[model samples]
Target: MLLASAMTFSAGAVTPGGEAETIYYNARVMTVNDHFDITDAVAIKAGRIMAVGSHAQLQELAGNDTRQVDLQGKSLLPGFYDGHIHVGTGPRPFGATFNVPTPDQLTEILAREAAKVPAGDWLVGLMNRPHCHMQMPNRWELDAIVPDHPVMLACGVLKLTLNSKAIELAGLSKDTPEPKDGLIVRDEQGEPQGVLTMGARRYATRVIPNPALSDDSARDNLRAQLAKFLPMGVTSVNIAGVRPNELRLIQDVYQRWGDELPRATLQIFLFPGYDDVDTSLAELEGLGFRTGIGNDRLKLGAIKMSMDGAIAVPDFRTLKPYDGKVRFDERGPWENQKGDFNGVTVIPKDSLYRVASRAHELGWQLGIHTIGDGAVVEAVEVLERVLREYPREDHRHHLHHLTIRPPEETLAKIAELDLIVDTQPNYTYYNNAFMLAAVSGNRLERQNPQRSLLERGIRIAYGSDGLPHGPLLGIWAAVNRLGHDGKVYGAEEAISVEEAIRAYTRGPAYLTFDEQERGSIEVGKVADLVVLAEDPLSVDPLRLRDLAVERTIIAGQELFHGSHVEPYHQRPPTP
Candidate 1:
């Protein structure tokens, strides 16, 4: 019988010379190394890979106390790295759908929530699936429901619907001048309409105290959230726009859980108009740390900035005007007068360059979110100027989500600059319909041009951006380029399964400067791996997302034994 644990031998047998602590054998080990080689087995010692070769070859390196796991001919690969995600440090908001809620239903829900809380307390709600075309409730409508409590309904991270009380509490009025790069929706009478977009949303959110910032249970909640990644074979994640308090909380979770939780890299975003460039830079430098601080479990990464809104919301800055028609359903078309609108530019050009220059000089990488073609051009121009002036090598400054394909010259400049492209393949799968409505057919055809970008020698990394943060889904979407409608949207953009896997694994490691140490299952690297039921390289591209993870191992220890767990004394981690 296969030994469930490492065999115990005399203390003298466990030597540090060349003995391995564990030998995982009888499996197809896809070592994502420089050569992308395949082996039969692998041996681990002291939380690092010691050897990888045939089962017989590894057996010679195993000590008497070495653990041996017979994989029964499963497929093993390096653990996945999620390039981008938003791990919220606040309590999850009460959720409702943007498409389903009627005025009465929304009012009823608000009334119920308002009654549960104290009169002066804040009541926050979230629209589960927010889109640009959906009709939003006005402040007057919300005031009719929860008059006493300050109500703020979030439509995504960038937009909010606030009641009059919330607006009052936030100190925003009709006369309150609009932020340089934010929008405060107004009525015909020149009064605040209770709708805030972009940086303006921060005003309401700042006043609403999130108990998770100081609550002890936040550690447990964060631990639980990080634990969820193990089941999906995600060993590393880079979270964008993390606040100071949230970073502290993340550290606490890692301290308690140690290697059991996924490794995290954080990016701090400077809110346009909300965060002063000079003051923010001073405060960051005063912290006595730049990017790449903290330990292996948690590290500071880039300073992120959103150049424009989300593409699906179609407020992303664009060179040409939007196609004024929104065809969400087959029933009919929704038309809006989008004449001469080239979308919203969140940061002024001067502010972007000033902040980027200082951050670069301070040894911080810049991660700018540019969804539209115009935004991409603007960001690239600024980066070009910064690099020309500073000329730092290996900066790895990245542009996130090039949803709208930029000009050929701009794309060439990106390649010339050696910048990384952190994009979400799952966006095509989940938001294709909305995207088609948001932009012209010609523009939509080039959405996430993975193959084109790869051809230009651009290192494109795959991320979920919270569109269901699963690497399998991202891989499937990247390989198939299929939408929810069961039709391929951008077939030319489809990549190979191997390419998709590399993007999800090795490509992201480049962002964290862990490419040599992690990302691959090479000898001398950390033994962070996942055992799959089938080989992803050989699986049908369409069924790739259905592949199951049999086990997840980090640092040579099995943290998650997948679905068919034999009931031993200990229970496995749960999602």
Candidate 2:
């Protein structure tokens, strides 16, 4: 119905100006407008879209100076937007190319890498394998293979296994007090077993020496890192959990090379680990800047905080005790874990509530990571109370990595509060088996409930969260709802291809307050679009991930051209 109306309305859709700088025709253009319109051509003037309609209708806006390009039956779409991501972070040193490496594979790789490095040098091995498969070697076992090197093996971000040398180098001992929101795992005799969790993992990371690079080198690395998304059809990304120094580097890169980088909104990470609530609040006040501080290219996004531990380790705060029936192949985080097994809350309740209230009062958007149902409920309750005390329309406070759906009433509250969700659908696809083993089947079915959330009029967006970041994989995971083992975990929650695309594009734009400027191919919106070898809507849903980006254009400039398209930059400048 919407598509029909869009076509009918196109007859009267006015072109922006009399002359255009370029006109692209003979393509299947998905405007992704209010109607999700499909148009035949689009005209660009300066860096904005001038018109979008039938080829004949748009041709009237073309002038003698305008350049014409034929898409030759390709498909055009609004560039993808990753609602949650990380900058300056990639695969760990000597880690497997595949994010998830089996334990045997990881140990062999680390051993080989250890031999190549100089004696006494630190060796860090990071892997994205789920905690269920994270049967890591203890310090003694690691010492057998890499005795000369100080080694730290990080499993699934939150868990860490360090050798004796690494512990010595980090200056940690059984007597060392545990950091706030962190834990030092100990054995029967209370000796440090070379294991850390949550905030405690920073001890190892802080002691790991890094290669110093010049500003130019750092900028080049940032540019190259962001450029990788262009070929994947991603044009805008919201990088969360960035430190202050990291923010400066990001700002510098954008200031110097704005045109070459993806549109970025960085969520400044805050709280007990990085800084106390008071200190962070003071820093924001002193800076005199809040969310939405920059232009379309780069912006200061929300203030992010993690409310609970990671889901991969099944250490996230939950409403009830874990079912605990599933067991890992070997000794893992949950293998013999004690207590109620309800998981840990990274942030104290009072602290989380206070920060949420204060941040909202100060006009800063909050992006709280709430992976467990318990955390989600707490966040919703706090936000509800905060809004009642100090209501602000369209605050756009979002919850990141909502791995489980809260109760229906809490969800209703979320809908009523207009809370936005930025979740990694690919996480559900990639870690479904592990998650199923960790949580109850009922909880697993409620995971990534995109369709249900949309039905309730709640806004949601898809992101990569740095685990093999790609919007295509996210969209595919969302539409298919398939696990790594080829099982459908949440069949009822599966969304259509069009719905997933919106979650990747317009949904993220709305989250970042860029809806009117660049989410769609409107007359005045920025011309950020991707030309695909095949139309996503026409292809098999299972093959969506295989779709190739032929050309990526941002603000009317082509930054990446695949083999299917002629290099626009190499062409002579239009006189």
The lDDT values for all models are: 0.76, 0.76
Per TM-score, the best of the predicted structures is: 2
- Counting only residues 3 or more apart in sequence or on different chains, how many pairs clash (N, Cα, C under 3 Å) in candidate 1? 0
lDDT of 2 by residue, 184-215 (tens): 76665556778787878778777877656677
Error of 2 at 167 (Å): 3.3
Clashes by residue pair, model 2:
none
Where is model 2 more than 4 Å wrong at Cα?
1-16, 89-108, 128-135, 168-180, 183-193, 210-213, 273-275, 336-339, 563-575
| Weakest ten-residue segment in model 1 by summed lDDT | 566-575
Compute each candidate's TM-score over C-alphas: 0.85, 0.89
lDDT comparing candidate 2 with the true structure: 0.76
Query: Which lDDT value does model 2 have at 192?
Result: 72
Per-residue accuracy of model 1 over 426-501 as CA lDDT, tens digit each: 8877665556556767677678779889989999888888776688889998998876556677688889988888
